[model samples]
Target: MTTASTQVVLSLTERMPTTRRYLMCEPRHFTVEYVINPWMDPTTPVSTELAVAQWTAMKETYESLGHTVETIEPVDGLPDMVFSANSGTVIDGRVLGARFRAPQRSAEADLYRRWFLDAGYRDVTMPSRVNEAEGDLAWTGQILLAGTGYRTDPAAHAEAQEALGVPVVSLQLVDPRYYHLDVALVVLTEATPTRQAHIAYYPEAFSPGTQRVLARLFPDAILATDADAACLGLNAVSDGRNVVIAQESTHLIAELRAHGYTPHPVDISELRKSGGGPKCCTMELRG
Candidate 1:
């Protein structure tokens, strides 16, 4: 109903400029090496060549828009390493390392920590609790919107809040299909004093209480259609102006465009076999 928050979201899509910087990992060695998520089935065949080609196309898409695409060296045996967004999240020049729930991904934490350290990020906090970094926790301006009940532990929310000096809102994920918060919720615009934040999410991913909380907090949020949600529509990467989303999420693409956003759809179907999408493959280096 034409609320102030709705107005802010509309203004954001109309006025916010594109972000020029991003960090990604080439899927050169990407494959469904193991079953870490609901989508990943070790028995099913995966094409590593196709995954790499699609990822390269995505990187080139960003570069064509005049954005800087920095990459991390892919380590052998870490198939999920291609999902760079799960590594860690950066805020205020400080990095918070992800403590993965699975052993396969836990070792990735150390590599990401080392990378951040070498990259000159001094205040890197190695989390003790099980948190998949940006996959579970995302920053809407300074406030953290965290998800739990699948990969990230609820206690880690407090730890992140203490480390980042920001308020953290914990949302409980109920569906295993949308394990990570980034897969269920997409932060479209950051909150500020004069403008409200905007987000898009699949309601079925969260518990009833969490759904109520989300509805109350973001009354203007775009509720994703069931078909779009199944296609991992919420797993989209937005640069405030341009939103790179999954090609199969047709409903979501139309929804974003109706809200004045420029939707850049890309085919990452090969990587989706491992439960990773466009947002999963990209991480924004917030300074």
Candidate 2:
């Protein structure tokens, strides 16, 4: 039952793995002390040891995949610091530090800023607007896809664009559960000279107009099921070919394979108590 259209589609799905550099933080003091997102419940008991173990496994996974993984020192009392992807958005060696919207996480921004500066990143700029960095901003190689209506302010979209010199497309999130853009959308293949960029996202997480915009922009984008999205499947990190995702997201894993992606599943259940998955714990250092 092979069709001409299916053959063409399969032929066009040429995927190649690219070596990536990533920044991560060990969940040494990780815990859900307060509620910032719907996924966080302070009442639920958390295990710091379990979080560390899971994080270590994830770090190893990236290393085994031929990617460079860098770590940042975690400050005490900032349990959520483990979600290092929110530290900032780094593009072409230019660093745009995060400005947290929540008071509980405000202190984290400066710590991350200092890290970037001390790490020899001379072009680091701390944003004035309330932006949670990679939590709401996703770089698709060609343009930046930014999410607003939750943790990040729409105004930060312009700030990011000006700072990074990349065109930014603002997508409005309507669901609090999918508060950050990373929780709802993942850039699968970043656009290059020969291929168009591809993404996988949950339509329900975005507003009607925003959903339409996504559809128009990525007609071949994979759509996540409700069950997959609930497990933070969209909160994944893809190196063009290999996608590091939550093991609980079985459906998304299957879909990723159908699309010619090799999905590497990791158990970050302990960290998910604080609303983070693989992508939340790993920030890509693009240059």
Clashes of each: 0, 0
lDDT of 2 by residue, 31-107 (tens): 89898889999899999999999999999999999999989999899999989899899999999999998899999
lDDT of 1 by residue, 1-287 (tens): 79977876776556474565677888877877677789998888889899999999999988887788988899988889889899888887778888999998777788888888888889999888997988998778857999998999999999999887889999999999999999999988787777678889999999999999999999989899888888888898887767889999999998887776788999988989999898898887877
Taking all chains together, each candidate's TM-score versus the true structure is 0.94, 0.96
Error of 1 at 226 (Å): 1.2
Worst 10 residues of 1 by lDDT: 11-20
Worst 10 residues of 2 by lDDT: 4-13
Candidate 2 total steric clashes? 0
For model 1, which pairs clash?
Answer: none
Off by over 4 Å in 1: 1-13
- Estimate the overall C-alpha local distance difference test score of candidate 1: 0.86
> Using TM-score as the measure, which candidate wins?
2
RMSD after CA superposition, every candidate: 2.7, 1.7
